[model samples]
Target: MNFGFLKIAAAIPEIEVADCRHNTAEMEKLLREACQRGVSVIAFPELSVTGYTCGDLFGQPVLLAEAEKTFGELMERTADCPAVAVAGLPVAVDGRLYNAAAVFCRGKLLGIVPKTYLPNYNEYYEVRWFASGDELKTDTVTLCGQTVPVSSKLLFRSGEVCLGIELCEDLWVPVPPSSLQAVHGANVLVNLSASNEMVGKHDYLRDLVRQQSARTVSAYLYASAGCGESTTDVVFAGNGLIAENGVLLEEAERFVPGSRLVCCDIDIERLAALRRKTNTFAYAGPSPAFRSVAFDLPAYGRSYPLLRHYNPTPFVPSDDDGKHRRCEEIFDIQCTGLARRIRHTGARTAVIGISGGLDSTLALLVAVRTFDLLGLPRKRILGVTMPGFGTTDRTYDNAMGLMRALGVEIRETDIRAACLQHFADIGLEADDRSVTYENAQARERTQILMDLANRSGGMVVGTGDLSELALGWATYNGDHMSMYGVNCSIPKTLVRHLVGWIAATHADEATRPWLLDIIDTPISPELLPADERGDIAQRTEDLVGPYELHDFFLYHFMRFGVPPDKLFFIARHAFGERYAPETIKKWLVVFLRRFFAQQFKRSAMPDGPKVGSVSLSPRGDWRMPSDASAALWIAQAEAIRTDEP
Candidate 1:
């Protein structure tokens, strides 16, 4: 029952203090607008009906009665649409007052989730007005002429997208019930918060939302109490955010006063697929306790455009200042990871094979950065260039230029003679430039670096990237082997941008120009011989698709666990004109075939830092069976393509 798409809306509706009628009207307006926008699930802030700051009026009999009357009318108003909405109101059950959120879908009251933690600290006395949900004795309750299930353990269902709800403080508790909800079956978490405004509070709130989404590997929708609420003692900032699998895609700045709704389609298929991939995540034994609440959401046709933000450089920050800050931070993660390894092992230096390619360039930069960080002289960092069969003048010049500019210890070793000797040593022909020839050169280069590291009393620094590992482009036990790979977790597309970022932000006027030229050079492993102009002859993209397309497919497919059909659906939308459908189809097949065939390389990969969510490190993020079949994926991809007329 995995639905292809989920339309979610984080609604910030207009409100008035203690004005239940005005609140109901505003809620209805937003609900209708959301329904028209094809939002299947809409969420409003906590205590939205009677206003969160009603104070002692929560116990007022007149106010309670009016709130119920307005809610009944609001339920009738939203009865026609398929979109289910959660509205906050003070509900009294068996003479006990509770700060609760009521859910309505398709004319029926689905369930009610009450606040579990009552605030009792300074400036906040929620204990005076509301009761915790743990105080509830039963699940069945009568609301607006029908019996609705009322409990904190409610999972409102719409096919494979199981949703769990919790009040604001409920999520903030040490042992949040939402944790159990996720362990059981809920894949989507909803939080209705009426948190008051305070300095340094938003940061905590943002982190809380991100961690919850990541912990569950689920989509999280947070609708905080926004504008129009009473600010008698505390103020509310209309903050709304929508996050999926830990990444914050959209967030509205607090204190903004408008009817704001951040709407995006959650890739339910992706979440479900990830759960399948992480087979051990089923810590909770299979149970039939989950109830499916049915609702018929509009299709919006097969292709619904994605409104979520797309990071062209997922590894590189979009903001200029932030990108520099991140470059500095990541430089630390790489150098720190390596420095600790070096210190623990008592290695005196770090040796890297610099090729002036993006991956090796980044590795060399990390080594220099690490030594600088450790107060070790640059000369302690050894850069060896073992040029072989496909040596290009551009790369050779760039490599020498960078080593000279950085003042690192440089060693020049020509691998042509050494590899040819090895070929002869192994009784192989040196003239043949096949996988053996290419890999022999790579292994020889690595051997040189490794011996150099040992001779220098240091460890070899690796430079193979995540994308290279995914495609198995690295020579197994050759370039793929390293003591600690600084670039292992970074992808190809991202590696290019990081080098560019360093050039723009850190490199000097002279050092920067050569770095830019190095980035502009074609991405080649340089296994094949050079052309007439002494340029690269073995371009990586010729065998694999463009790194950008593969990266896009990788994020949705591996990170979110989206299916091939939906993935192709998204690729069509994102890279429509840039790449023709036929071309995308061809590369997509290449990606699947290569990805499945090459997981063995990833299975035995060296130690590397994980920079992003989707990593292929067998010990870390991805742990797939090396022989897992790509037949299903390839078949689905084939179906997406219509044969030429």
Candidate 2:
């Protein structure tokens, strides 16, 4: 019941028709096993105690008696365990039977949620034996030995988790009960189902659960009856699923020999954050007042074994096929945006600075692709290489080679002399190397590009990536300012992959070696003087931090709006083996300070297409004050100092 995490389980227990005693025993066995695995909330299939295919046997007095006795015993079994369990059964009240899910915690019955919609067409006739929840005479019904609230408006709460119960057919309705429950403050929804196996039915069922969870922005747990039921009319293949916000976290294998139990850890904090960010989710309308049942469940502390998979590189997909599709889509967006700018502005040439780095290389590729799409001459693309004091032979030669191989109009300008002259004019010594010395070179190169674009009747394509913008790594009014920034929304880590994809798929044989070599080269701004060996002397990572860590921090903080404490916790789990906790904590502090202090830079950023969920474009996605204080974020991060490495 922690705010950040809730461990849930979906169980399918083997059952015999009209054999409530044996079914209850089997359910207790599975429940104990799941609880031992640290599952806090467990949901079983619909009519799991009496079987959904009991048919006319559902009305037999003996079967009804056995179900009531078994339900009481099941409630007692949960008394010794801290886990809350939801099991389906038939509840009789006022001369009519209702299909309901009995929810209990510890030794008390929480409530009974009656099935609102019953399927009565085509091999299904629940209306023949049971009644829908719409015709309730009273709000309370006798369950086990105590009277509990029985209505469609009952919500159960245990600590920070709020749960709403729905049956099988309820999810397939035009508007689901879970939707209203979510709007009324339910963060978790559990469904008890007995859907029969059929061709293509599983896909629709899966999509239904996913779409419902996504629409409500809640965590959904679904459990269905399995092979132990009477398969007289339809085969019951036990299927269990656990999903959070449209993403399937865990699902059990269908048509297995025995009862299946699948468990996952859902992030309740993320759900809450999403709801708070969405205006419609908060201001939809006034919902009906419902009964709230509070129960006690053991609290999971700050740390626990994670059942959900945390991708180390959330910005980059792991699958090759997904990566391919993503790369294609991103390229399409970049090229399309550049083409529109070109056509709208009536520019004939595209001038891009070629530094032989990943960002510049990607920018150049996009420029060439846009020209091709617009049916412009390749020679109309002006590729400029301004070799400065720190430019090494590896990068310089790669730049020249790529420009020649791409068959673009190439231009070269040496800015060392211009920067030296500027330093002399400013009364600064060349021997005294400092920030001024570095920035002078960057500004000189940008001046050359701007001038070249003006002389050639073209536009300057910016190469600084989203990571640089986020950390304020770019020189203001130097490389950071441009007419158009193609890589403005791409992070540094993903820029490498995009370049690799182009080299492997788009580059010719003559250009492939140069592209690969550029990728193999180290990332540097090349602002200072080169080493005696004519190699790159200043590494970006050594000065700031790892781009991987920075990208991870940026994604979770901005995309999910996760606070610093939870972000640090998740990062520790995602990169514990690769990076030390102290190292991560240190850079996390740097990231927070820089992100807050550099809003003014992002505020004036050039227009670029957003290709992913996270974008810091001021006019599009993120808007913040330039002078906002980082005191709260910094204080939260500083409090997390630990002795562990």
Candidate 3:
């Protein structure tokens, strides 16, 4: 279901230069098809009606009349279609001719936005034929027996969607009209271009579009002239792009044989939420000249299918190359931060607790890299493995093996004896296996790490990741408190990837196997006793819910401030096949409760580098009162009916 999503498309139709009738027919066919596919808005390339390569022919009054007539006919033919369509054509107002984009719905012209910038240099001479609309003396133009608003300041609004149009060179200008339009409340920016293909231009254009979308925090739709355009001087590859807030959702194949429509759904609600979250987005009030033109579109409810892809693991990159690059960058950030801290404090050694789990393993790897970066001996980074009741042989053996392979000083301290003694002194039964029992082991391990660091004038590196921090899964004064946390902003889902990346790219043959084994080991605090088979008995997920789900909740909840219901809506779509809706709702409730209850932990979190957009560090990106209530959020989440599609 398309919950708060608007489906939009960019159409590249076969066109004959100056043959307005044929162009109109092709555009109509595509428009109808897009409407049938439930596209709420569709855009065509610049000057598509008469073809962009008409050159000086754009000056001919007969050709201009035909283009106008064909545009009217195209609208009339697609009157029954339920989509807002933007078509490009030449408009002559009084004695001046201007390149324009016409917005039409239900056979009616809503508005026309003229091209602001006329590119007069390089391989093109658009100034030779068309005057910049910026010079036009009038705000309205008469066409097809109707007066339509023709200005760069016009915005088309339909329900929750507000779109602003720009033609060709307008996007290339230093300050595109879209910038002001977005500030004036345009959530979607459409660009129509007849740009020619050249070496390295496509990538540049894509980057420009994506960056503009990001800067404005809106969806940017771009449709360029295609194969049918004149190749007398240059070639048009028919590039079409749809991007939302820096991400390119869909791109049409360049140089395809026939007509093509690139379609994707834009999350209008997400953009609005982001705009509300960032004060700078709307710092400048709406422009006085800008006008909003209203239009109508059929409501797309939950029954409509969502076309965009939502990464189940939002914290981790989806592709292998991206994952590797991200891991490398994160590793560098961690090392740089730790190295700076070490130099600043003049610490001689780096001490970390190795659990043979993802978070601890990642922390150890970062410490090793940090020591290497600072030109310190690897032996100076002490890897301490504190095994307790729940320490399985597999994890214990892997921890020892990894520490030895990495050339780090290894120290094993069985905390069972110390924890039992503490329980006896505290008047608690050793067999209780309650929070006290688990927390006793955790505090003992932290005390040992802190003492060892003190002995060598080293600092304690934290192993708790973002997931643990979000869910308050760490023991407050135990695994939670550290001198410095390298994985403070790294999520559990990403920790696995980072460790796996090390295994594949950075680790030597001797260390790769142990890293791989650690990556596969189930995450646990190892405070409880092991089962008969020596496997981990207290699986973290079994108690706290899956890290993947928790990480997803943390990202949307903290990063975008998405409320519980909407979070549930998107999460169901993201992990629908992998988990049941009831299960999602259950964990979402847990996440909200724990997230609010755990703010105290995050409020006092150790110093850590911010690697991504979402961070729980009190001194950084996120700041919240530890006493905030989750009652309202939990209520909204509880209202979600899993029976609904």
lDDT of 1 by residue, 1-645 (tens): 113667798899879988999989988888998878878788899988888888888889999989989999998877887788888888888778888888887677877878888878877789998888779887767777777877776787766777888888877878676677787778878889888878998999899888888778788889988889887788888878888877786787777887778788777777777777778766855543544455555556544456655553455567888777877777778878888887888889888998989999999988887788788899988989878889898899999999889899899999888877888989897568678988988898888988888888989899999888878888988999999999988888878888888898778786787789889999998878999888898888987879988877777777767667666767766664687878878888888899999999889888878766678888878889999999999999888853421
lDDT of 2 by residue, 287-370 (tens): 667889997776656445778887778888888999999999999999999999999998878888899898999999999888
The candidate scoring highest on TM-score is: 3
lDDT of 3 at 10: 96
What residue runs in model 2 are displaced by over 4 Å at the alpha carbon? 1-3, 283-289
The TM-scores, one per candidate, come to 0.85, 0.96, 0.97
Point out the higher-scoring one by lDDT: 1 or 3: 3
Candidate 2 displacement at residue 70 in angstroms? 0.6
Instruction: List clashing residue pairs in candidate 1.
Output: 226-238, 270-561
What order do candidates take by TM-score, descending?
A: 3, 2, 1
Error of 2 at 638 (Å): 1.8
Error of 1 at 306 (Å): 2.7
Q: Which ranges of candidate 3 are over 4 A from the true structure?
A: 283-288
Residue 61's lDDT within candidate 1 is 92
TM-score between candidate 1 and the true structure: 0.85
